[model samples]
Target: MPYQQHTAKKMARPTGNVRWMVVGLCFLGMVINYIDRANLGVALPGMAHDLSLTPFEQGLALSAFFYAYAAFQFFGGGLADKFGPRAMYTFSSLWWGALTAATAFASSMLSLFGVRFLLGAGEAGAYPSCATAVGRWFPKHERALATAIYDNGSRVGGALSLPLVILIVETMGWRESFIITGILGLLFAVLWIKFYRDPRLHPTLNAEELTYIEQGGARPIDPATEEKISWLSLFKFRAVWGLMLGSFSLNFIAYFFITWMPSYLINELHFSLVKVGFVGMLPPLTAVFGGLFGGWLGDHLVRRGVSLSVARKIVICIGMLAGSSIALAVFVPSGAWAMALLCLSYSGIAFCASNSGSLCLDIAPTGRHVAAIMGIQNGSANLAGIIMPVVVGLLVGNENNFSHALMLIGVFGFIGAFSFIVIVGKIAPLTRAKRVKVADAGANNEITH
Candidate 1:
């Protein structure tokens, strides 16, 4: 189906903001997704004592989730692309939710690891589905902000988990915490199934808004005519590698916050459980605004006629550089000073994350492959999730000093900055013509400009 064109004057009339509602759902899904995943980190202290786990064992259990999560990302993306976001989201949410509830039954290290791994597999479909949905619903100029809105859920959920999970763990026990979050996910799946539809099929979306979306570059869902790109073939593109490497580096540092921040507060800084619940929330909470600002700034730049490539790169580089402040925390003497630096570091990570997600949509071969590409990058990035916890666990060691770990995360921030600034080239869709050229030339050669 062809897009309906409308003049600027006609477009000025009320077109409705149904697209915002779609993004709102994406946001809620992400919030639940993070809450389920991050709950373990907060509950780990009590859980470790209850199960008689070593620090290494705790790290192993934490890393276990990423093993399946990273492995399934590509597969999940393909499923999202093939089945549509609505089905993928509903299926993934239900699967993860059930697994989260099942975590309550884990009585041993092996069982906990097994449950967390399955939960990872179920949660892997989330962001890819969100990326696919955003590509189909929002125009280019608005994509970054849309990405930010949903991605902010990670920060929100992470922040909320500190206090919420702590309260649940204190009141009802850690097992009950998992059950409550699990039920929340199950409920969201029902809402998603009932309300989410493609722009073309949405009963409430006005024609004017649809036309505005299409004209501004929102992809209209039409699978019959969509081009199918080979999944393996994506590796031939230099930009794809750049995205993978860049994302991997970013996640290397970011995962430290997800898996170890609470531990760092409790063990290294010697904070009480009550203080951990309140103070631990600061960095991620600050990150929430950083992500929103980054998203808004990127979109604002595009609307002011900045090239997409330049606009995105500038934000990404700045964010990564800012995130390098994590290292500075190690040199600080006071806990307040250390928290300030950590907060800055997390804010910078969130700032870059919004645009990093947008890049998947920006460089996809077509709307059909957005989720697949997202899966590829996210799959690679999540390897950090598997590595960071174990690495931090070892570095913290018997003495429980986190200085080495902080320095390592800070260095990776610089590496991530370099990857985005130097490795990633111009931002544009990789068309079929380019794909065919790479195929003809052999995957050994980089994609032609």
Candidate 2:
């Protein structure tokens, strides 16, 4: 592809820092997206008390969102691929915002479950769209940083919710917190639809910036994927499955912190709601640093002449080793000391996670497929999300010992490390097949057409 020549030839372009502006917008969207989702965990504890639910039932409520969330991952990606990032993002944000508000109106366990399921389904498209958008707007070199900047929202939102949602629950009540957060998402959705577009189509994007992006390896939109690859062909590559497996390990650990950690502190450790909320802020705070450091380090390694494949894997493995701290932290008795260890554990998790989105873009065959690939990975990971909460709930079932669940989480981190090192051979785009066969329908379409 004459990427440089084509991009350089464009006359009208958007002005300075608009690419970074796009990254900034996505970052705020991520923060808002997470705060809406993460608040449910904080709210669940209170909702359980009022509803007179068992731990098992509350676990069901916790897991319900993931059911829809996991199921929609592939669908969301397809939507992003077909519709473009702007429209899909706008729709998802608006839909989830509406569902978040609907959550406040639930009167029974079934109602809450339905609302959560809908909410998860609504939000499932968000990250995949973000992944697709990043692939479009930024070059390959800056993807990790852009991903970290936005992905940091998972931690920032979680960290912010620690104080924000819990204090709202402590004061005005849990229902109102949903109403407030939902409104924020609605507002962001409007802003996003108004400002965002594919870089090739972006009216404000300048020629110099566009050329710079393409020169740095930004992928142009591809219509070729429509003929080049089939849904089954995606499975022909091992990278996709490795990503799916690794994401499962990561999400299993993440949901533990996001959905259950607050309950763990309150129920087992006997901490006050306010106290737990404040301390809960710690892990996400440290995770912010992890996201930043991981992005910069990964990018730095690539710039220093290291292979992108090796750099991503090395970064991922080191992060998992650090993340394995969860197993040891389970044994610590002191609340403050345990908080310290949890912080380290989450930082490592974020550090490793900072690369996951980049990996999705790295392997995407074209700009259009970025979200779809991400969705496959996300959906697979969230499949575990659907299972782990219930698994942990069953494991804890009226017991104070979280050691078993905690160890399971730590073990998953190691599994993820192994998958990246051994299973996912190289971080590169999926190349279309060259051999022409009667059965090679995908290639045959390209050849015959």
Candidate 3:
């Protein structure tokens, strides 16, 4: 498949590192994405106290976002694939940003749930779009590192939001915190729409950069030439199921801290809000290194002549096994010890998590299907996101003890690892042969040549 589909319009040869600029935008988008999500957890202490929320009610509020987020992943990915990443990303960011700001106006629990649900629906497109864009811009070799840089936004956001959200809530009130985060998203949405483009379509992209991307094997899918793979056909491939189930397991741990960590710090550990802010930042901060390490390791192994498929799987398995330390944290006695253990747990999980994102590109049927693959995995993962908070609420039954929940989370970390090892098999582009194949299908240079 040619990276560029439309060749009628003459274009200038591109110059400079315009592709990295796209990566920068993606990195920023991710930061904004998680900051919006994580801010709620940090501010929940104040918000819950003011609103008189029960533990169950708090869980409901926490999970409500995922309900819509999960539901829309299917829609978001399809839309992004159909409409293009720039438009979908812009709209998704703006909608979520508006909802985050509107959260300031929420007067009751019902109102809050509605706002969060809508926010989830809007943000659903964010990652799929990012994935699709990355598939378009970077080749197989650089993808792990590229994925790490952008996906690190989640950890960085988690790390920074701890202090930033708490400070804003302490000084300006929780409502103001939402508004501030919302504004940040809106600003980034504009920058994304302003600057991002597929390499061939980009005005400023020169021959050097385009050649680098194409040579790297990050070939673009042309809608005009490729047959649409039925959504139902995706399930026949084990990689699809593996990704869905594996992500479900991995995200379980991730959503936990973002939704519950501050509360855990304050209620069980006896940390004040200020203390929670400082203490809670540890795991996510460490995860930044974890993400980098995982990405680098996979790429490094590939450079050392391991097959790409094996390199990715090895990284994922190692990361997941390391993440099982979360289960061990439950046995630790001190808050500081638990924090240290969690730092290890999250680092390992994130290392695997970054590879998982890059792996979607590896296994996509075509560039057009990148967002779709991402959506399937993320949607399945958010099933955990939607269920975990509520499950923890039930297990704890109005107390702060997360022992039962934590154990279940640790189990999932292993499940993610095991699924990747056994079910995913070889990591390569997956598709059934078309009944009526187009000429020169998957030719790799349909337009650029």
Candidate of highest lDDT? 1
Candidate 3 lDDT tens digits, 167-279: 89889999999999999989988999999888899999888878767766684877776656777667666677888889999989888878988887787778888888888
Q: List the residue pairs that clash in candidate 2.
A: 13-205, 13-206, 14-204, 14-205, 14-206
244 in model 3: Cα distance from truth in Å?
Answer: 0.5
Writing each residue's lDDT as its tens digit, candidate 1 over 265-332 gives 98888889999999999998999999999999988888777888899998999999889899998899
Local distance difference test, per candidate? 0.88, 0.82, 0.83
In TM-score terms, candidate 2 sits at 0.92
Please provide TM-scores, in order, for all candidate models, with all chains considered together.
Answer: 0.95, 0.92, 0.92
- Tens digits of per-residue lDDT for model 2 on 1-449? 32221221233333656788888888889899889998889898888888888888988988999999999998898888888889998999999899988888888899999999999999998998888888878776677888899899889988898899987888899899899989988999999999998887889888888776777667667564333666556766667778888888888888888888998888767788888878888899899999889988887787667788988988899887788788786788787777787888899978988787689888777666788888999999898879999999988889757878888888988998987777666687766643243126532212232
Better of 1 and 3 by lDDT: 1
**Model 3: lowest-lDDT 10 consecutive positions:** 439-448
> At residue 130, what lDDT does model 2 achieve?
86
* lDDT-based ranking: 1, 3, 2
Enumerate clash totals for all models, in the order shown. 0, 5, 8
